[model samples]
Target chain A: MKTKNGMILSRYYTIADFEKEEAFLREQQRKGFQLKKFVLPCFYVFEACDPEDMVYRLDFAEVKKENKDSYIQIFTDCGWEYLFDVNGWSYFRKLADEADEDNEIFSDMESKIDLLGRVTKRRLVPLAFIFLCCILPQLVLQFTGMSSEHSETATFSTFFFWFFAAMFLVYSALFIEMGVGLNRLKRKYSKG
Target chain B: MEEKLKRVYVPMTETGFYILFCLQEEMHGYNIVQRVKDMTDGEIVISPGTMYGTLSKMEKDGLISFIREEEKRKIYQSTPLGTEILQLEVKRIERLYRNSKGETAVGK
Candidate 1:
């Protein structure tokens, strides 16, 4: 971990990997760094601290700006410190102590599964819709030469198709990854 | 309608049971957590994620209804439907406890 100006910037794509993200943050805390804020598109800002074991958890919520304060107050009142919100997900941490139950921000399997379902609806569904409804049709049209073209628009059209194709590939990978992660969490919780 | 509701909610999850139990009186999300903690003597603690999710689902299912807001916090209480379901659950638990205690045989 490198620190300059009292903050360390680390990059991690944690969109669909909540458990991995929590483990990463916990490891950082164990190394004497605590996460301060999360910037969009994978930047985590950390502040130096004494090495301590901290448990980090993520929750997906659609809190409007007006309701944000009360929403956070609920968590804070329950002993979970509010760290930051990024992309509709809230990050929280608590000290890992002798009380085995304190480490979890979710107490029951049903609630854990519900949280994953919300995350799927909020983040993954939209990406999947775009990939299937928008990008796939355009790609098919381009490949089949069914899309009308003119000399003037040919270059721009070709560039646009390739750009969208690349984006579709990336979104497709993300959609599948997120779907799988949610399913795994659901299965794990449903078993118990 | 009541019979159907009971069928759906008879086997309440622990979290759902606690949330409905706490909302017997009007309270906000945070207050419900504290109340449950106090009632259970720290044996059960509902996390914010679980509390909020349960509250939302209960409200949507008509098991709970929102009262006037105290500032930005939404106050809620169990509806008649919620109370009926909770009572059924309590009776079910009571029977389980009584049977397990050998006061009555399992099939009797």
Candidate 2:
């Protein structure tokens, strides 16, 4: 099928390549072959042809608005195996064409996730600059004979001076080491 | 006198290099991915997402230009300045090879 932009839908199928096996399974189903009683420890597998290993199964149906051919499969597995299983399912519903525009959390999540991503993106350079901008100037004044040793002006400046000085002394070497290590890892993993 | 080669900023990636290299033949994104994988012994794989992203960035930077879209995928080729930079990079690598040859020969 071609869209408005003249783009054709390319269908690609993967997994369980033997068509004959699928046909046989379908034929067996059509013939009313019932094996429910014979199979004692059976599992209701929605996605797979025959049932395998699983716990309790629930039956529920919901409409998918994106694509008309899409459907969902929910699997209730035992233990913490649910963590490894994909949570949500999306499918195209039959009435998707006539459905109203629904609420979207994606755009909101996208912005929040984007901020988190950028915040953690590049830290070393800006952090170093912040330290340089705030702390470096005070240290300069202390060692340069520009220290205001008289009255309250000297005391207040000296207090801030030592605070930044202590912070710089403690954090500088550690930050530099971390920065170098990060750059090395970045270069090593860099595809160029 | 050595010509002062202008630097071109491509994405700093193996996929970026392969994409730029394949554009010497004016191929599309999927074709570039296949050709690059074939050339690199399937060691490097360029995801469709990365390919399109890099292509857009390169086009924005004027290092690549789109020729036409065929069968949905947009075909692209290197610009004249892009080709010039490729040649300069080739020369740089050749010079490095020559310098390494002397160093290797010294130990032998």
Candidate 3:
């Protein structure tokens, strides 16, 4: 047995990148570093093990605290080892050898699309709402004639406005990217 | 409601069919999976993601209802609508099976 001691930090913006995340973890496992735990947002701790192919899957479930066990038990009983949950996303991994033919957490295309739809509704809809309703309007107002009348107030407001505008652009780009990725997934499954 | 359900769920997916069948006796998620696997002789295995996703959708569609909670496990059983739909699916499957067999064994 290889000595188990390794830690890696990674950042994934949205649940739509779940496939990429799973691939990354699978690659790491191939190199004998199995993910032991995941810290919220962007930290993954791994342990060394015999090199083996593993399948990692992510499910975005905002399970109630009371229902957490039963939610996890189903996966555990089905030979999927529950790794961790972060930000309403649950990570599960199983040895490749043990998995059934499909090896997917979702068996049917309709259910897979539905799961992605849930993630989109839970995570993307709110972001899209904020961008369309709040940030975009504020940015438009700031760019137009909404500057403060007083020079001091105007200078401060202008600085803050530009700062927020930049942040909003970054956030908006992320939201759009996530939306496109999710739409692609939906289309892929819907087509299948 | 029955007509609408038949239209929506007539040709049920294999996973959905087995799940509703398993829920006839008020089983939890894990138990439902086990029962399906046993009943199908390992031919059908509903993963956790698929199971819960189907359960949530079925519940939202009024096809199933939560029976009670037992130590953090939520017991669910098919509602009347679910049972009706399951029966419809069974009959549909039976018709398909019978037709296919009849077509294959015309001479025999």
Candidate 4:
């Protein structure tokens, strides 16, 4: 969507759906909206640019602040334009002609696997911890309370029970989706 | 060599090996990437992400030490331990090379 200015602000990406996110940026660039930067929780801002087919790639690395310059320098030297990073997800793009045949930010299978590992450890692991420790317990407790004390605060308990249950389902779905996606990527990259 | 360091660096990936090897002389991540691409005749171009990640890992593992900053690029060189680890890895690669050529060990 475009604001009064000629800039486009999109909010249709998720941490788990990075493949789609990269594609989304490429599509936008094709539509003449070049990505300028991003805000957290899925807002990718772009400015007007000449329509060109470029390849966008995302790399998940927990780099230190002091090392960020050198981190970007490496990519800049290798012909990738580092747009920006949000939450350890660095956004980069290169001309389609410049990218290698594989068109990947990682050259080796080991580094590809390493990127997946970082995503899992940084994203999925913490979500799993929240699902197991916090969400699940609250969900069970709310359900029990709703069933047992259906007298005074039945409506209140029922609301919370459903709320926690919905949260449980959402978290479960996210976890499974990302787990499967990452595993599929790992398996795909591991083969040759 | 320490067991932990050996396990980490001995079976180093090509990215890791080249990064650590090139750090024998102080160079930043981009320089190493260019050097590796040129060395391999562009057969093995180390992507910038891999180069940065490997350099950070080696720096943290004490295999490479940061020397100074030049134009916002941090220069690095192999520590004594890093050079030692590189030597071990080179020897291992030499053995693999010889075996690929079907050469038997000459003397113990």
Candidate 5:
């Protein structure tokens, strides 16, 4: 659950399906609690407000302090109320009008595809790389070191073994789940 | 006219095309969005994400250059390189238009 207002809700919005997160925020708006700010790793803070049809959208921009002002200004000029940006994800909302059924920040399929590419490039790829190069190597080392059979070294290796093993499984599941999700979304836009 | 840049942008996306087209006159990003919507009869609406991304990419690729900022909105204009690419794209579109004329174009 993302929100019901005043009470903070912690819901992890995976990078794979950001559209889902946007929908969730819109749903929250419909229910009368509007997102006030967001904290990393799944905390969405909301404030009680009159229920109104507000369209929420997310943009993946690694905006820096220098240009963030102008970046938000452009959206403001175009009529989007800039909520807050967390990490590289900028959240926005605007009153849903009569023809706002398909209201979007990016008007074309190619731009949508570009958004997907940015998410994959800036977030997913680097995370996947870390799991591949760093975690995978440690996993192998732990497995080999577990063979020492005695001393603090053996105990240390056993402890490290389980830790790496758990991390490996976590990384594997995340990689597969997000990888598939990204490919499916990309195909939907590319083929649609 | 680097072949690399042409390959990357010659067959410009609608978003790219309009951004370049609108920036032929120095204009704000949001203004360009509105202009494109008007020009296309509301067939397309450039979202802030797409607008920002295209403006940034075009500026980097030397297609659009920043002119100034007013009210915090960055103004942009097409560059010489951008104009060259746009002219090439116009020629391509002209060819497509002629083909769309179909059998009725036998006289022309």
Candidate 6:
């Protein structure tokens, strides 16, 4: 399709042309009519970004079919754009690569995952030490009959609470680390 | 070299396949987007950010190469390797269609 500016627009071209046409349409200051183009197998739908905002795209749709009626109907049903059969593979690859790049950019995700793993490991050491230092010694004293006839009772709930608390602390840390790792990997491989 | 072609699969991602698919018609980025939208009934969408990124990656991977930049938009075409991948994907999809038919129950 040819535009008023003498540019022969087609199914495939550069983004600059798309942006330029958008700008020209906006500069004319016409209200309601939108300047849309076929970027590939899709529609580069431009809408007013804001009242005073530069004319920009709100979203685009994959034009899998040549028919505008089908395209418009799908767009009306779901805000997401439809991809044409022709551009399906290319668009998928592009989406996947973008996800991969974004994953690489998340530097902090790696460290956060590592930090959580380390703390979880450390929590185990202190819990073990508590068992050896307090519980084990007390049990030994009771077994050896070192306690006086007037014995003080230790509740099972207290022991259960401490044991479970330590376990939960470690589990929580490990869980956080696992979550971070999965998220990072998802980002790294997040191809659409 | 033909055997090596088997190593590359048309990526499952829509953009990669769409880009390669459009190149079959010998088009550039903008045209590819239009063709894809037109073909897909507007179900699929590609943004400039995605278009540029995919084009660069495909060129790097030797799946597609730059033809030329006319009026600031770069053109791309499929390589021999890319063509092989597309053919393979076509075959795979065909098999998938056949297998799916077998799994579906016949109407009463």
lDDT of each: 0.81, 0.45, 0.82, 0.83, 0.84, 0.48
lDDT of 1 by residue, B3-104 (tens): 877787889999899889988999999888888889999888888888877887888889999896776678899998899899999999998999788767
Worst 10 residues of 2 chain B by lDDT: B1-10
lDDT of 3 at A64: 77
Candidates in order, TM-scores: namely 0.85, 0.38, 0.84, 0.91, 0.92, 0.38
Off by over 4 Å in 2: A1-123, A142-150, A183-192, B1-17, B24-31, B38-43, B47-61, B66-75, B83-108
DockQ each candidate and list the results: 0.69, 0.02, 0.62, 0.70, 0.74, 0.03
Candidate 1 has which clashing residue pairs, if any? none
Report residue A126 deviation for candidate 1 (angstroms). Answer: 0.5
Candidate 3 DockQ, CA atoms: 0.62
**Candidate 5: docking tier:** medium
Candidate 2, position A121, lDDT = 40
Q: Which residue ranges in model 3 land beyond 4 Å of their true spot?
A: A1-4, A98-102, A145-149, B1-6, B68-73, B94-108
On residues A1-192, what C-alpha lDDT tens digit does candidate 2 reach at each position? 323322222222111111222233234334432112111132212222232222211111222333111112111100111111111211111111221111111112222232223323444456667788867876777545335566576676677777778988866865765555544434433432
Instruction: Report the CAPRI category for model 1.
Output: medium
Query: Which CAPRI quality tier does the interface of model 6 achieve?
Result: incorrect
lDDT per residue as tens, model 5, B1-108: 477898888788888888898888999888997898899998878888888888888888898898888888888899999998999988878878888877244666
In model 6, the fraction of reference contacts reproduced equals: 0.00
* Share of true Cα-Cα contacts across chains kept by each model: 0.74, 0.00, 0.81, 0.81, 0.81, 0.00
- Pull out the clashing pairs in model 5: A105-B47
Per-residue lDDT of B11-74 in model 2, one digit per residue for the tens? 2345566678788878877677678779989676564334545666677677789897654456
i-RMS values of the candidates, in order? 1.4, 14.3, 1.7, 1.5, 1.4, 12.6
- TM-score of predicted chain B versus true chain B for each candidate: 0.90, 0.78, 0.89, 0.92, 0.90, 0.82
Measured by TM-score, how close is model 6 to the native structure?
0.38
Candidate 3 chain B least-lDDT 10 residues: B99-108
RMSD of each: 3.1, 20.1, 4.1, 2.3, 2.5, 19.7
CA shift of A23, model 2, Å: 44
